[model samples]
Target: MTDIARIRLLTTVEHSLDAGQQVVSLANDEDPLTLKDRVGSIERIELHFPHFTDGRAYSQAYLLRRRLDFKGDLRATGDVLIDQLIQMERTGFSSAVLKEGVDPTDAERQFERFPAFYQSDVVNETPVLRRNTPES
Candidate 1:
């Protein structure tokens, strides 16, 4: 037998978060512009890709990484596929939650599909030839 000794009260804070430590979820409809003010302190941003065809998440990821300059973890959840893995990494998703039954090994193998890229992207910020070529 157990007796209830004490109960603690749970209170909610009504203040603006200081150096926000919260992981904010931005939906496809929710513009990342709203987070501009608090982007710096955001530890992580989870961009929900409701379906594979919805490519808005790609733009959101790029905006967050390139425009906002967010260096935190950008995770993709929902409808993640092995075929889109490379694009996800290029756009700036540091981690992803792939759909069920998709082999992790296969998804990882997709990254190696292209050994090198000619243009710059979030993954390879510099063009390969430009960096490798010596000054004339």
Candidate 2:
């Protein structure tokens, strides 16, 4: 398993994050590739989910990490749930501000239950089975 930092569960959005780092927030529909030019100057990007059923933000995170090469923090905000934490991290979200009333401790367990994945994800491009296999 790739050593992903523990997913943070913020009760509220911290407007001023990380000691003056430039933070940008994007609506679910916004295209992350459009920020390619500004990626280097940004320290964090928050992608809103709006509703648990709305998954556009996942695509946004993937584009930011794999296409834009955004190395800084990628945060998921709004409608965040314990069910989404694992996929969020796999898709490049470093943290999340979960929806109101969701227990942080319960959310944390989602990672423990499934520590490793067989499929490729943004953090690990190589499938688990192919990772150590000799080239055909």
Candidate 3:
């Protein structure tokens, strides 16, 4: 979960990505890399969630958008649940790499069983704002 760990993961993966900029996986604990410091200036960011019970990547992705203003591909990798896809999209993820052996065809169908929006007042992992209101 350290920056070094993230860098190591990035270096290990080989894939056809967005473009000249590196397409790399980042750990939740790693400090966000600024645009200038990134190799070839990162065009695609793959956020890793070590487990479904761990949601650090969601916050990482949110910060990348709301704070750093990253306007490129955001991909969720590892321990992705079918139920979380819509929220992931809402959180700014453009794509997801399903865990090994998870069927793509069944993912969407399974996802529909969960409510698209929740009714809650808490702000934590997967914030559900304005839950008290009827619109929520």
Off by over 4 Å in 3: 1-21, 33-40, 110-136
Question: Which of 2 and 3 is the better model by lDDT?
Answer: 2
Q: Give the per-residue lDDT digits (tens) of candidate 3, residues 74-114.
A: 77877877777656665667667766666666666654565
Model 3 weakest 10-residue run by lDDT: 1-10
TM-score of 3: 0.61
Q: Residue-wise lDDT of candidate 2 within 8-78, one digit each (tens)?
A: 66666453354455889998988788898899999889999889999999999989888888888888988
Report lDDT (CA) for all predictions. 0.72, 0.84, 0.60
Residue 109, candidate 2: Cα error in Å is: 0.3
Best by TM-score: 2
Of the pair 1 and 3, which is ahead by TM-score? 1
Models, CA RMSD each = 13.8, 2.4, 8.8
The C-alpha stretches of model 1 lying farther than 4 A from their native spots are: 1-21
TM-score of structure candidate 2: 0.88
Candidate 1 residue lDDT tens string, 2-54? 11111111111211222236688899888887889998898878788898999
Output the lDDT of residue 87, model 2. Answer: 93
TM-scores, all candidates, are: 0.80, 0.88, 0.61
Candidate 1 structure, TM-score to reference:
0.80
- Which candidate would rank higher by TM-score, 2 or 3? 2
Ranking according to TM-score, highest score first = 2, 1, 3
Q: Rank the candidates by lDDT, best first.
A: 2, 1, 3
